[model samples]
Target: MESNVSELVERLGSDEDAVRKMAVFKLQGSIGDPSFADIFIAEGGLARLRYLTLHASGNTLAYSLTSFARLLEVDKGWDIIDQEVIQRVVELIVTHPLVNILRGAMSILVSIVSHPYTGNNLSQGKDFGFPALKPAVAVYPQFLEMLVNRLSSADHALCANALQLINSLMRESIANESDMQWPKFIQKLQDLGVIRAVYSLMQETALQDHMHPLIEFQSLTKVLLRKWRGIPLDLENPEHRRALKGIHLASLHERRSQDICIGTGTGTPNSKKHNPMKWRRLGFETESPIMQFEHTGFLGMMDLADYVRNHQDEFQKMLLEQSGKSGHQCCPIARASLSVTLILYEHFEVDKSEMDDSKSYLLLESRSNLDKLFEPLILHWTRLHIAGLHAFFRLWKATGAESEDYERIVELVRILIESVVGGAVRTKDVQEVEEEMASFEYSRLRGLQMELLELTYEDVWGQHLMQMREELYHEALQFIKEQRIRCLLQGAWFPSETSLNLGLGYEKVSWTYAQLSHNRRYLHFGGFDAIKKGRPELDALPEKIDLSLVSSVVSNVSASNDPLLPNEKDIPPASYTKITIHGHLYPVSTTGDTQKNDGQNGTLSKSAQEVVLLSLHPPSPSVASEWLDGLLMLLNQQPITAKTNKLLNLVSNYGLKIRLLNVRFNDVAFTAEAPPVPPRDDLDNDYYYDVFGGT
Candidate 1:
């Protein structure tokens, strides 16, 4: 264990910056004392963060820094700080070379303030001060004043995070000020122009966006103003109250205001459409909402081949990014991966009937092209990322959803796959390590292959496609347009058809994405395989590894009451065990609810909590009523025919009443519940989720 620890420490100190970046980012997943990992950012620690700010070329830097800024400071146990670096970071917040890094830094600062460690003594905010202070104030009063002022900088992009931090700090500071701290904390706040600073800043941002932070800040402002009346503050007003509410906090009120915000089409200047769906339904039965997509520009058959020809490194980087985007989809890199399987599928075995007529399609195996692709592929895997894959996948499918166009996706996935990932197969050249467990584990492979594909397809198009059925093939076309997935569609392999070739109950599609993200072999399984098909015995692994790690993972997974590789057709165990994630609670859904058919659609939807988040979090009824109404409708609907109904009742039925609860784990599709139809409506479902806690 000591040797392994030393190796980890050394890996944190790897000379290769890429290695160092990965170490820093992956450190967030450390199983041990996460606080210990922060020491790496110290003087003796890895200073890779410095390079990330300047080197914006490689997206690895952007991801690492962004991840660090997001997760690190939130860990209250991790109180590590380098004031000098922080000073630089704050200074660079507005002028950073990279927009992402700046956003990340701001997020980290907010997370830091959110931790329990925040206080007047240990922290600083708007400096309203009688210098005659007590030792309890660890942070100087003036520092607090500066922070408060900075927080209210009025530049939404600039001061949003700082503003939030200051607001929380003020809330705590005002409520907690005493003789033990600065003398007259409240009086000092009044004296130090806190109202002026905040009000001025609010005016500046009033004309801009509500990135949700505005609502939070407004609440804090209201709290402060209520205490200090005659400050030109009145929450009694609807706008004032509405602005104080979070996007989802207080749904009903928000809806009324949201309705006002969305005018009742008066024609000329003001009579306009808010959501495209309104115009869509009014315009045509299948008309779509206006959508803005970030296209990568590689479209059509020629564009597909040309994209393959020129941007091999870029493509591979994308694959690597996607392969490990979420913990669930982290697969093993083997000799034969998705690309290899694609080749095999094309050469050795071709399902002619599945092929669609295309203008031009051919195999791509030129040594030069592969060689160029190899460099990016290597670079991508070396870092392990996701931002790049979305870009790459979009580019690869820029043409029609032709099977031939998706050849690259299939090939690369096939080539890197370790073994029977999802249902796809891949082999590692293991002459020397035949008796050793050297390759990446199945958990990793299955997590990426089965999980993500299942998730992406299902969430993006599957549920709506299945429920709406053949009549909705045009809907698929619409979704493709709205989602812009059609722009990336490969015409031959996975092209747009006017029909559903396979029977896709919501469950299969959800699981397929789950399989793709993690279990790569899912494609080969055909969704019809029975459970408990064949439990592979614990055999000699391909590498000498820690058995305890494997044991811990299995224990954790089983502890959730998730099945232990059950037969394909077997009903999963009804687990009394409940797991929580991100404050979202997940209880096992019983078969009665899991299989319940709601509506004529036969769609199984999410539970009440899934439908109504405002039950725990007051609905921001003022922000948008349509989202709330849609949610309420989904919530009220019984498990008679809808996907969400079955899902909600599956956990714990509420006698057809709407009751929403919050849990640490919001993604419950994998929690031993029979997976329902894919959540096509992003508002209602999920195909898969990144398992956060377990390593």
Candidate 2:
């Protein structure tokens, strides 16, 4: 065997191309045998393979990668490699046009990354056999970009390979047990769009099969949730740095103890601290799979995994519904749909021990005699968990309880509502309701509230339920109020529209309702029309004011009481107020229509380029301060970037071109003038000459 391996290695350097190909092919065949692998590496086979990777093409390049990657089975192989070699391999995997070569390169990466020692050394902040692979942070950007690109491939094998590669990368990175690198890895995934791209895989039909890809997806998600649940490290802050260092030292000591021989260890004073295996469990005693699943909400993920494995048709329908019928109840199929949702929430950390209590608490709260009938299923249902809550509600509704159970059911419903509202905490784990999950949460909560209202409508003992409903309403109202105030204080108000005018009272238009909203590029005030026309519709379309055109938002102003209109210089003191936008001053006053602006009324000129003042009168001085502060905060947003302005300008020109084409096609008016451009300091710049691809 030794003589044969030597002959093969020597042929790899043959003068003829055919001999070289046969020699490389034979070496590839010997890579699986550890003895043959050892001999090949010991005889400087790696240097020759590395040379081929740099200079060879096509099948020769593929065979070289295959033989070289398999030889990395030994620790001695990692010792001899460098960053240039690893980078060359990754570049080949990323840039190679042929699918077979890409697959071969990806397989090599998956094998080496799966090795336990690779992860162990990387996590300890030691060399990963190469400088590029050492930090992980430095090379992750390119690595993640290439991985995300492959996820969009239509070929099943290619997509599976990409998913498996991602799974291996995350597993090795997380296994390092080092707290400092953990959060950084997760953050990099987020920054480079890899996390979001991976999430898009949930909708992919081909990748959801009961294969290695699915298992890898589930495991990668679990590791992500665990990292999110842990405290973040801030190296800039001294106190945070100290905490991270303490955690690092503790983890290091734990790793060392696990390596020590068992029972040979002394019954030391710090036995608990020294026993790394014991501390690793973090108080989770049993080795039961269910208990293990409970820690990471893995059970919910398993439920989803089962659905994807055994019920492909049902899963496809659920995906379609999530895309088209978002915010509507998942009726008729609510049970099946909620099962998948349960998995998503579990993986996302919406269901946790801290927020959830046992179902025994629910049983103790209910006083109905019919409780025995529901007890069996109720026992299996988890409370304060979103999926369990929705499932139990649907089941109870479907069961058609007796009339006597109404009061008790109403009480239970009250308990559910309060639990959901009270349990809401500022957690990164509880994912915000996106377009898909919208119907699963708030809408269901509203349904529960309505159920309570209907049950308590007219019964003698219903007074308590009615009061609870009222309290819940007030709680909801207060929540919205607080959220609004918080948005105001935080300066992150959602872009919105409001009715307004210039407050300069015109003859035909005593009041004009206008809409307002702000984006990064401009402060827009549009939707202008007459108030007395009684239609409550805008007479003219809205327009946007570029932020670059505006100077400031101010309140100190004097205005004229002219009914027709007033110029900026004609306004007098004490009888009027106004706001200045883009050097255009318009008077402000309360509108007579008490229904709008919280009963505060006024209107100025409805003409273009005028400041539209919002007349809001709160019920109290504090409310007034909140309204003012919120407005000021919204107005104080940072200046728009040049890139954003350029985009807005291009979009504006495209719309103009579209409207011009429409007019020409209809022959409505070939002479119709284009709308005047808004005044801007940078309007003279050549920013939009390429709107039609190019001039």
Candidate 3:
């Protein structure tokens, strides 16, 4: 094998072109074997291959690049490849017209930038072998421009390769100190029209079928814009701001229309008119046929918000599909689109007082669309829920507390708090609960909660807070108690009984408290006003039922229909607020009942088996359904209803974090002095944190 490889290497210097091509082809095939590859490189094969890439053309050049890429896969290859060969490879990637040559060159470039030892060392400023190569590919302005230009290529394969190479370059750059090279690299790419070109590619109907690469490219562009350290365009400058707001350059026809005017002396339009100095003063040139800004960077020439608005339908569909998944299955396109939209909105829509009619209108339309898209899905999806809360906070700040939208946003926040608290009750695992409390979603939720508490300092929003004060306080208390209790269900309750004179009169109804233990061992009730006041003694609740004797739980109508009982019409048939528990009555005393039951060997006399009924009512239909499902789940019944099962799953998965969020909300909302805000989660270091900063 060694002798044969030596012969191939010798043929590369042959006089005939056919023999050299054949030799390169045979060498390309043998390079995959490690032993053969080492021998070929030792025999000066790498230098010869690099020479072929620059001097050869078509298949010969492509074959040489492919062989070079294969040699790069070996361990010793990077030690020998020089900076000139890498620079020539980048040139081939940009200048080559054929897809085959571009593809092979791109693969080689990706390998060089992605190699573990050399790539890592280069980014950290420690040179293993390729010191100059990093600047040749990543830092050089012309090289960055060449990569951005290939992004607009019509060939999908070439375009994808370009995107991959650019992404690799960014990854390498991010490892450096504060990504020091990123700002200049990103600025140069923007100057070369990369952002606009990428935006156009995303919207092209021809590229719709090949959108994975486009989506990744768009995502990378978003990251660069967000972390670029300084503003890319000056919003303080009127001309720059106007350009960012998407003022179109006037075409020659429009300029001509402005130039012509109807002369008062005649009933016909004049063929020519004096150039108006006013037009020039208004930033439109009268003498020049074209109108454009002095600074022509892409950031100044494009409206990112308008781009998002144009693709609103596509984004809506992606979000809808993603929100419907059972887990946090994020759609990269949707997340990237939303993140870019958010960054743009945060930067441009800062102060309403500074906005003109056009800017205000654009901001309002964008806000309205996002509100519609996120409102219905937030409660169902965790990531969208976080996003919805973020948008709501922005809306609240922009609209002020006096606007009607302010009240609506407050109501949404209140509902979200309740949902999160309710979900927290279902979590039982200590480790899982700890993990959730430490999550990114938890930090954001807590931040919003603190914001809401701050609103309580004002009279108008404080009234809304007062309305839910009792409820919020009660929930917070329950969350504290539930940490050790493992409560399955707990809420306000009303008990009703049959009367001899008045038929099923609820006129005597009084508010009471009820709780079902997680172990399904007992149902406890009593302490009404005390519990509402956030003070309750669980063991001293005054009434308890052994669930072992309970037979069934029912809703809506009465549990008994005997003639002696009150007529159904007398109570008007309790609908959404009704619950009935039926069980057998034991002859033993309520005290020491457990011991008495155990002495009876879990059996009861026939006379002691008489049916007993207990009727109760909750505050709402949803509460009644919750009680029904909790009871049914404890019974180990199969085929649970979908609605009940969904509620169960939500509580078990998201309940603990939400409860902690509510507790924090209440702590801030009720305190006299504002509490220190919780620290924001360190998202830059969390590997599981969403790229868009979701949970």
Candidate 4:
């Protein structure tokens, strides 16, 4: 039946315009999940989508049509609109002819799925295979085929979005009513060939084996097969009753079906069949299988002999170790017999007796008593006892629920991780780490602790912490800059429009602050004026202000060599006055906008320079006294080159650039510095140059 629909869809692509529309209309109206737009994009997708969108009467058909390029452009109004329909119809539109007809598919999906307004109320009482609000189920086989076929296409978001849609479609049914009709779905699933397809997909590496449900599928199959024995395969037919004989595997040839279809990646997923699972029944214990062990008599006798041989020495050691011991201290010979006193609690410990006494005759008869007898063995082999508690802690974090004890442990773990990872503590974990201080060796745990914490963070905490760290740095920089601004005021300073980034009224205030500060040493007025008027003898000054601490990385820039040489006075100061500070220069004109102060070229662009707050001047003394007392608040932020950079590399967080730009200095002694030069323009106007790829 579905084959006819497939054949018609292929015909629509090559058929006459009128015939194409009819075929498309039927498919779109029937199955709203138009995923074929991906295929059309594969070769001459652009041309095809253009044809579809221009001819379309409305966005109805084009809405479902989307390719990776225009996925995010999808809108809500067009979301329910079947895209393939629109694609076929759009060939008629003359304007925007090249526009991908599949455009806005993502926008449509995101808008409808995440809409705060009309979303939830509109999606109700719809049955398309999976009880999902998804319109894809009516053509589930087609949708699945499209997805599997498009797996190799360059677009990842396409697959992601498709999966998201499928999950959304199946979400409610699988979660709420899984138990009610799961088995029946499984039955229908086998009949429609989904089980065989899924099994084949499971075997293929292309399917995500690590997906959360894949493990559950394997477990479910084992349980189902175990329960199949003695249970009738079909309750209605007497001849259908048969005991399970082999592993519960799905296969095209293995299934008992009326019309057996060959397995392909795409199989019908549509089924209103009630789930076979009983949620309330809970676990494999609900239905135990009747196993027919032909060699059970021989195996049981062999197991007794093997067990005696393996444990003969272990029993002797226990007798010698506990020659006179008794009670809880008897070295627990019951299960696995290993016990350790709880270090922190002093008295409360893992109750071994609980394991031994936990056995129940019916449901708990098999696996239950083994825990008691092998408790020591598990502790030795699995580290199960302590690990179980930590696992509980992890669950607490994941679920967003916390008890006082869990919360306290979390806080402690956070502190320990922060101190170590931030490099506050240097020594690696060479010693055992204690939870409390004094007993806690900060340095010893710092190295080992971060490694442990890294694993914890890789899951959930790391991503969250990284986001929080960025926010904190921005905040910290703001506070530091505010203090830097306070120091930027004093006695004398040069005004560089392009130099210090003072915008609006802030620059004037900063100028005023620099002019009136009490401690001075804020702002520079060098280059032209720094040269002694008539004396060449006193004009001598050092070359580079080599403050090694100013930066750690090798740079082309050296500290300012202020005041032009006595010989350089012969050169006239141009329209712009520039003073090189740190490694860069600050420039401002009595004219327009400024640009980056390149070494040879000082050409100022009108847009490059901006204004700083017209902040008040700091306290003044007019000499290097203030500088001697306190260091100039210089901002030297290099790109994130280390792991630390991983947390702070954002365009919004680029504070170092801003800090380096806004510097203030008073007239200070200089050796010999050249006056500012005209900036050379770049040959290529289209090319953009940036240090960190513009972050």
Clash counts for all predictions: 140, 13, 3, 86
Model 4 alpha-carbon drift over 4 Å, by segment: 1-140, 176-695
lDDT of each: 0.33, 0.45, 0.50, 0.32
Shift in Å, residue 3, candidate 1? 7.9
Residue 304 shift from truth in candidate 4, angstroms:
23
lDDT of 2 by residue, 1-695 (tens): 77777788787777777887787877778786887778877777767777776677788877877777667644436554555666666777666777767766776666656755557666655344223354442554466677768877766677778778777777777766654475576556556665545545543433333145644454455445544434333356564445323422332332332222233233343445444433212112232222323333433333333333454454344333323221222222222323333333443343334213233334433333222211111111122244433433444344333333333333443444344433433221223312112234544654565444455453644776456545554444343344333433322111111211345343332222322332344333333322234333222425444444343554322122313223533321111223333323322234421222323456333433444433322222233334333344345532132322343344443443343234344333234576686668756665665322333
| Residue-by-residue lDDT tens digits, candidate 4, 287-348 | 22222222122122122223224444433443334333322222222111111111111111
Candidate 3's residue-wise lDDT over 1-695, tens digit each?
A: 77887788888766777887888888778787888888987887766676787788878887887787778766546754556677787677655678778877886787777676546555655442223456555635366677778787878777777777776766566545544555565556567776556655544445543344554454444444334322344556565556433322221222332222222122123335544421222122342312232222233233222333454443344333433332212222322223323433243222223225234335544422322111111112223233434444343333332222343444444434343423443212323333343332534654555555446434565665454554554454343333213324544444333322364444533455777754658888773432256534567578877787776776652232223223545433233345677776553446424222445578543334435455665544445545655565565442133444454444442443353345444333232566587676874664564322234
Given candidate 1, what's the lDDT at residue 100? 53
RMSD of each candidate relative to the true structure:
34.6, 29.0, 20.9, 29.9
Please identify model 3 stretches exceeding 4 Å from their true place: 116-142, 196-695
What does the lDDT read for residue 109 in candidate 4? 40
Better-scoring candidate (TM-score), 1 or 3: 3
Candidate 1 per-residue lDDT, tens place, 561-639, comes to 2222234344232222211111112332554222334678987565423221111111121111222222223223211
Task: Identify the runs in model 1 with alpha carbons over 4 angstroms from their true place.
Answer: 1-8, 28-64, 70-79, 117-163, 169-212, 230-695
Query: How displaced is residue 78 in candidate 2, in Å?
Result: 2.7
Shift of residue 343 alpha carbon in model 2, Å:
11
